[model samples]
Target: MMICEINSHSLPVRPRPVQGEATIGFLMRVALANGYETPRQLWIGLRTFDAVCKALCLSAEEENTLFGPFPSYWGHNDFKYGLTAADFNHSLMRWCPLCLRESAHLRGQWMLKLCCVCSRHSIRLLDRCPICGSTQRLERANFDRCICGAWFANAQYVDTDVESVVRITQTLEASIFDKVALPSLPSLSAQEWLRLISYLGQFSETFQPAKPGKIANTHQLDTAMSLMFNIGWLLDSWPENFHVILETIQRKEAAKLSIRRTFGSMYRVLYVDLAEGCFQFLRDEFERYLHEYWRGVVSKRNKAFKPETVATHPRVTLKQAAQKTGVAPAIVSHIMQSELIPYGLVDLPSGRKVRSIHKSNLAQIKALMNGCMAIGEAATLLALPECRVRELISSGIITPLISRVHDKSAAWLIAKQQVQRLFFTSSEPRNVFSAITVRRLLKYWHLRDGEFMALVQALSESRLVPVALQSTPVSLGNVTLDEQEARKWLEEVRFQVGSSMSVDEAAKRLCLKQQVVYDLVRRGLLVTIEDKLPGRRVMRTSLEDFQATYISLAEFSRSLQRAPRWVLKKLHVPPISGPLIDGSRQYFFRRSDVCSEALRVD
Candidate 1:
């Protein structure tokens, strides 16, 4: 008989790290340096600052000094002291096109304004020249400085001066203004529009027109961009479409320019910050639902085998296939887009066919699907869960499959498709889990098993279930014990899946002077969750795996057909562990030590 036990255990939930006061200060410095100048960004900074202060249990006055409106450092002129050039450098390293080498200008000469050959007049045309700057004679010199003329004379041809930096910033700003318009058009989706809005705001902060008596700081480009968005003049219109939004914003900007020109970018940022609450509201208001309504189709499984032979093969539905595979129906639809399978085969209702590659070919398929070679085997071969493989499937973009597989006790299997899908490297499915799907599932539906069969059921059907080979903690019989002995025995067993021998018996068997058995439990070699004789919570210890510790490098070298030096290099082991012979012509190494090092590397 088998049992599915729920411990009724509500595991302690660790809270997400809330930003503290110091972190808020750090963030403010970062934002100031990174071009987070818009009113929106300031609001976000203030909220973050306030929350952090509250988390740190700061006094009301201290909180006010840090994040309060008007007189606070955040709103005062002195806030710039908290930020530095290094912060600017770090920000540029992450998001700036020029600093990160993501700009198209790196590849070739970028035409700024067309200059005439006489150096007197300039035009916006690409082919024609501005003043003395004829398109033909135009030597593509790196902009060494801003219009102020500072130059970087390094052999690497990299410019570090603020003047040239400002020119590039202006160029990007112009690109955004010319190519992209505010509130965009209805032709673009809401998500695309939102993304563009944020991108524009970011670009504006990075590039602002230099003011009189103010030196341009490449480090402060991030701040400038933020300020531009806050001023609202950067946006000409918020039209519902291409023609309307652009015209409106342009008209409004022209009107504003004609009026008092006192609207400095910094003042504009201050205005916006006062209006918008900060980052959270922006995120919530602008979040786009990137998922589309996918129509599920009924299709036959690609089981090429004879129907009678594989009949009771337990068909997994289309929804189930999506769940198990960690793939979207749309993506599966893309795979089988137009590829037809044999008729009369089992398939899902949404035109999705049940496909099966030969177990031998599974490895090849997995390689094409995911990068890892043996991961699919860990789930399919080892009978682990689908959730275990999802992270590996998603890679670093989301939770790693390793996180799911690790249950703080033992690894278990979830879904075979998750295993196969994650391990197959050639192709990958994107946007498999949509926010809406997750939200709906979590909000209303109960979580169901995504796998085709349970572990025991699958093993039972195949008759491949492992039999007891050696004495493990699970296999041990409990003996009579006093309370102290029982406590000692319990201390010797920790929960380790696939471990054998009862906790008490294993403790009894290992009669050591010190707490060696207890050490194993602490190190996660034993599992003490199972019910023992007389109803005590006792578990078992898994057999010690030598692969975890030993690998013979010398033997490995001998097995390789390649040159010994090549094998040694591949093994990444030191060639010698003993004193060198005369003139370093030869050296000696301990075979045992080499093997030991190889084991550690593995």
Candidate 2:
């Protein structure tokens, strides 16, 4: 009844399409029937690929008898996947040699691109010629001879370990007709799997930056087809096999096992080869595998993914870890540098290794810190002055979470919990423990840095009692010490220096020249007590009284960074006592007057 109306340049002879034959398969068979070199030449002779496609879909009733009514878009799905209709059959000419001899037509099963071995024959399909090492074409009116004049079907299919590959091919082909995704594998649609097979196959080995390889012979094409086939087997089992493949690859490279080296070309293929929407499932599953099994460092520098949807990633960035645990990044780094917390280094373009603690150790970083505080807070918590706390830390009596000497953060982090457990002195206050804290002794006695360290060490060793605790601290101004005990310690320290002052001794104490001290003593502005030694001796109280109210012109000039004459003339601030008033060679200004006028302090 109906006929496929033809153009002037139409195919000469047409055979009935075989039942379930791919439309492209029908074209190749027609090309052979018409004695064309290939299906492409046949389509060219018939004007266009679309023109040939239309005639086949609407052929005469006698030619269409092998199949019933046909839809206009029957084979469009297979034709549109990265190949033009003219190039489709030639580019992917996979076929079973024995099956080709049995029936000289491409089977519907071979149209499943993933089908490596023939379903009926159970032999790997050959795409390239076995004898002349040339890709086999749909020859003119002949199925036996290749373009190189060799018998194509006589080539025996080599048997190898293709069981998994064959099985995977069956699985992927099943997904197409059944319209169901395999439950064990990632749930990708049929079209997605069809397009993704060859794209994913190249990632099976370490990626060389060369061009796409040519399949020169049957063995080479089989090897190439096996790559696409192996992908399904690798994915069918899920992560157990996935991890095995990665480890195997690492073993082969013999280099360090970083994810970047492990999944060499996979990342490039995912991020750059395919669109994100097409292979999103594969990308996500691979990323999950990396996060779960790959115990390597990950960052922006390497191609490993940095996708963290939830705040609770096992391996988080340094800043994220700090924000989650309420710890400073510097403290976390210090913990890692001291090897208190274990960490690994991620790759960076700058070659700076980031400290990456495992989730287990990351949690411990927060636990080990009962909480961090400034040194001042630590001193207050321990009921000791900041200076005393610093001394204790210096002498290794207390261990801080962050070492003040080692870090440049300028904030010493001491564990408040560690400080609370310290024992500054006996709990009960006796008469020996005075109400006055060591803070007062520091100001009153002018303790040297070494003497202060010794005093704190004595307190740490239980040699003294702290009678009072600071409910609140004015920068650690209070931590009680016995007044009598403190006085006795200072007296012993003073007596060790002897009861006297040579002119040099007096000048050093007063921060003046020897000549100035001599003139001041001669003027009776400084008093000297008797000493058994030959040197002139100034009493301890004398230096204190002299320095308390009056600042000499020499000290004033040094403080202002000017000469004495410049201070007297340009400053217009007269001294309270001088040669005219005190009969002294040295001019002395009151401390308040010098501070207010020379330094512009209120």
Candidate 3:
């Protein structure tokens, strides 16, 4: 009989490790071949497993095959694409049913969360069993049979019709498994391609808010999969459509003067990070586009605009021109009205009308407001406390070009973005990190050995998008920004999801050794949940795949290369279950003595 007997009976079937088989997969096969329910039941310790391998006289290649290219880090799969523990699909079994029916060996690449499609069969991988309506457990006795007595090979799956998903998966597979460059993706290393895709995904899809700090789960993995949506389309076109991405980022930046301060983390990733030389074309194009077309307002009074920017975008408001030259605002307005100076009256977004001054006429408005301003006026200008301004002077941060600090009433000043530049949160989804306000970012958050400008760029780029919107104009003290960068995505999202259970309790439920359970939980090989309560909880489903008592017609059709219904009709045998009788799509045939009385085929 094909019925799996999971008792004390020990019929050892220690097989040679296949070249591309995963370690956990080898253990699963070894246990099942010997009629054991789980691999841990067949061994006392990892030492015993090693001893069995020693007895087998396995070669070094075999060892590497079974344990992965790196045995030490094999438990966590850090070897694959520089992803963290939460980014992989190690928590649950993701299977290509047809592949299991054909080879009955697990492929290591399936562990990647990006490996959603099975190219060989052109079908989406099945996570939940069709019959049981539950996610599969790795502890089953049979690969083909689900614990619910349904055949995996017969389970109908959704086809991967999306060309981008298929192409991207294939590209990733080739890079990871074969250790080659992406077939046609813009000249980037395998790891860099992954990074580029991830950053772009984070930038583009800010509308779908993720539960930040609570990283990956089954649902979250699905969300992560969605992140790969337009990556293929973007890469297929290369730098040609790259401007579309830049435009998207620019729309989010509240700061318009400096690209570094405005584009934020996005800027650092492209230009500051030297290793990303493959993105040089993008950086060059970005600079070119800004120099020729950008019209950011400039003024000697604002100081935010660089000397280079004045030559590039020299337009300044009448009030700013007056502030620069110490001339009255009315005189600057009157000069523009009389057409004595080359200028235009521009309507601001806030509905205020202001005359703009030309670059040639800017010398007429040259003056300094810094030294003469009172401490209160300087405090208001810099959006800081008088004490903080004094401290800044003491710290040598406040440069006195015109102010004499010995005069107690005199104060130094710099223009601030002020209340008009106040930040507001959008329903548009940003990133998977907890949002920190610009106010918080500029004032409260501390980064020891971290770049402060990078955080500012993240806020400006909306990577660490606004969470709180101010209804009334608030001071710079209230606009918040917490740390956000490419690296921060992996570091910060650590909130506990679900509840907890003891290790001993988890080990027994999952049919694993206590030590094995410990390793799995630590490495995130299994789905580990943390609550504020106690230890992490392990949600191990039951392992009851006894045997293949019945066969589905789909399985028969696969072998016979005929239609399922034709194969079923030609068999001339009554089925145990069918679409007509039990509403099950599959037609199951009893295998003689084990399930029913024997029947002979014509």
Off-target runs (Cα >4 Å) in candidate 1 are 1-161, 165-416, 419-602
TM-score, per-candidate, Cα-based: 0.17, 0.47, 0.44
Candidate 2 lDDT by residue in tens digits, 200-302: 6544434433332222331345554766555655665765666665565555543332565555655556666665575676667766765664444455555
Of 1 and 3, the candidate ahead on TM-score is: 3
119: Cα error in model 2, Å:
3.4
How far does residue 528 in candidate 1 sit from its true spot (Å)?
15
Best lDDT among the predictions, by candidate number:
2
lDDT of 1 by residue, 1-602 (tens): 22222122211221122221222333333333334533235344344444433434556654333310221333332222222222222111111123213221211112111100111111111222222322221112222222234222211222332332333233333332233322332233222222333333432323434232222442233444343332233333321122232233333332221111222432333233322332222222111110011012112341322243233333333444455566545433333322321111224446645443222322332332353234445544433344433433444212222233333313332233333322211112223222221113222433224311222222224322222222321100111112342233223322233324554556554432124434444444333454433432333323233223322234355555445455555554454321232222222234555655555444
Prediction 1 global C-alpha lDDT: 0.30
TM-score of 2: 0.47
Better of 1 and 3 by lDDT: 3
Off by over 4 Å in 3: 1-11, 43-45, 48-52, 66-87, 139-141, 177-190, 205-215, 218-221, 240-242, 252-255, 258-294, 297-602
RMSD per prediction, one decimal? Answer: 32.8, 19.6, 38.5
By descending TM-score, how would the candidates be arranged?
Answer: 2, 3, 1
lDDT of 3 at 275: 31
